[model samples]
Target: MTWLVTGGAGYIGSHVVRAFEDVGLDVVVIDDLSSGHREFVPGAVPFVHGDLLDTGLVEGTIREHGVTGVVHVAGFKYAGVSVSRPLHTYEQNVTATVSLLRAMAANDVDKLVFSSSAAVYGTPRTDLVTEDSPVAPESPYGESKLVGEWLLRDMQRAAGLQYTALRYFNVVGSGTPELCDTSPHNLFPLVISALVEGRTPTINGDDYDTPDGTCVRDYVHVSDLAVSHVAAARRLAAGEPLAPVYNLGSGTGLSVREIMDAMVRGTGIDFQPEVRARRPGDPDRIVASGGLAAQDLDWAMRHTVDQMVRSAWEARRASRD
Candidate 1:
């Protein structure tokens, strides 16, 4: 079955595309290049440069490519910035999803894999979040994703849309040197860029109630995450049963201090990270239990902290060249 991967030029999407290729699946990519680099897309894959909000364009692409399934990975992903740009966030994440669903229904494409986020849980009271945890999204970005999932659910009831939403937490590392996290707000890129530029990386909060007095979070390698996407897509194509939502998380989490120490060891930058005041609404810990995803999507923490740092550092440095 042919599949269309939205945002397939971005870090995680590009890796998902590669994973599809590795499995010998025919895939097409659609990316607006807003935050994704064109170079990240493989030379051999068919690419359509356009926005998803254009329903006609989305429908034409699906029909032209004979797409039977879709991996919806495109969205406005910055949680902190979404507070100021709520409209833009909704337009990209929610409205765009509506448009895509419309086009999918029009063209009879019923299978989908959505790239959701852990932010949907907001600040969970418990340290280990399960799939059944209450969804109280605080940011517009998170709300948009939750809304997207709701749309899919409603569509499933209305049109028999087979789907799964993968809720990601702190996605890091690289499957290949050609693709790397470039988000200005992501911890890995921010910290790695600071070190590469000879600036000290700052830890947002060092007084959090954790073993290292820093915020603890789940950080999964991007390649491992990509594998799960392919698995979800395969399951969808084969009509295998799947949960509506799955959390791709490390059952246990690591602290920011531990990440910084790994960066120091990996990059040979033997400098301490600066401690800064805690950002408002920052939770001390937000790790999820991947038990559900582990059983269904073959999810596991395959990369160590040092390996995540090393792979990300290598890819970031390569991109600068």
Candidate 2:
């Protein structure tokens, strides 16, 4: 049975596609190329160019590819941007998800692994976010992801749709140099691009209540996150009972200054990052406990912070124009 990966050409989705390839699983990809690069998809894999909002296109791809399961990864993913473009955010993340679910039901495709976000928890009150943490999304983007999860929950009860949602924390690093994170809003890219262009890196704030006075976050490598996606898909395909949701994160925290130090070692740049005012809505610290994912989805911290910095640096350098 072929597994269809929506948005399989984007940074994270592309890595998920490679994980499926490494396991010798037959897979098909459907991406609109909005923020994804078509070249990221391998030529051997069947690629469908279209949007998930088009139910007909999605249903046709499922039928043409004989898809039995899906990994839903496409969405309008910028949290801050969603604050201003609420309508656009909901349309892309919520409505598009509804369209996808409808297509899945029409085609009798029941098994799915959804790509949720830690933003569903917003700024957690606790030190470590767990699967049971209260969901309080602060942005339209986060709200959209939460709605997608609810849709999955409703469908499961209504139509017995077999599914699991993985709420990912900060996803960084790269599995290959060819597949690099290119989003302008991400930290790794911002620093790497500055270093590449011979500009000094800047930190947003340094007066947080954390140990280093900078925002602390759980950073997991993209490759590690991708493996868990594969594991979740395998469990669903095998009809093994799995949790409805899992947190894909490192059960630890890293301050921005600590990451800067890592960048120095990883990129060999001997410059201090300029301090700036904190961006509004920036949380003090938000790390998650990956114990649940580790126990069930083959999740592990396969890369260190320095390794994350180095991999991102190298990939950025390689993909420079």
Q: Could you report the Cα RMSD, in angstroms, for every candidate shown? A: 0.6, 0.9
The CA-based lDDT of model 1 is what?
0.94
User: Which pairs clash in the backbone of model 1?
Assistant: none
> Which residue pairs show collisions in model 2?
none
Put down candidate 1 lDDT per residue, 162-257, tens digits, no spaces: 999999789999977888899999999999889988999999888889998999999999999999999999999999999999999898999999
TM-score of each: 0.99, 0.99
Candidate models: Cα lDDT each = 0.94, 0.93
- Point out the worst 10-residue segment of candidate 2 by lDDT: 312-321
lDDT of 2 by residue, 1-321 (tens): 799999999999999999999999989999999999999999999999999999999999999889999999999899998999999999999999999999999999999999999999998999999999999999899999999999999999999999999998788999999999999899889888888888999999999999889999998999999999999999999999999999998889799999889999998888899999999988898999999989999999999998999899888878874
Model 2 RMSD in angstroms: 0.9
Off by over 4 Å in 2: none
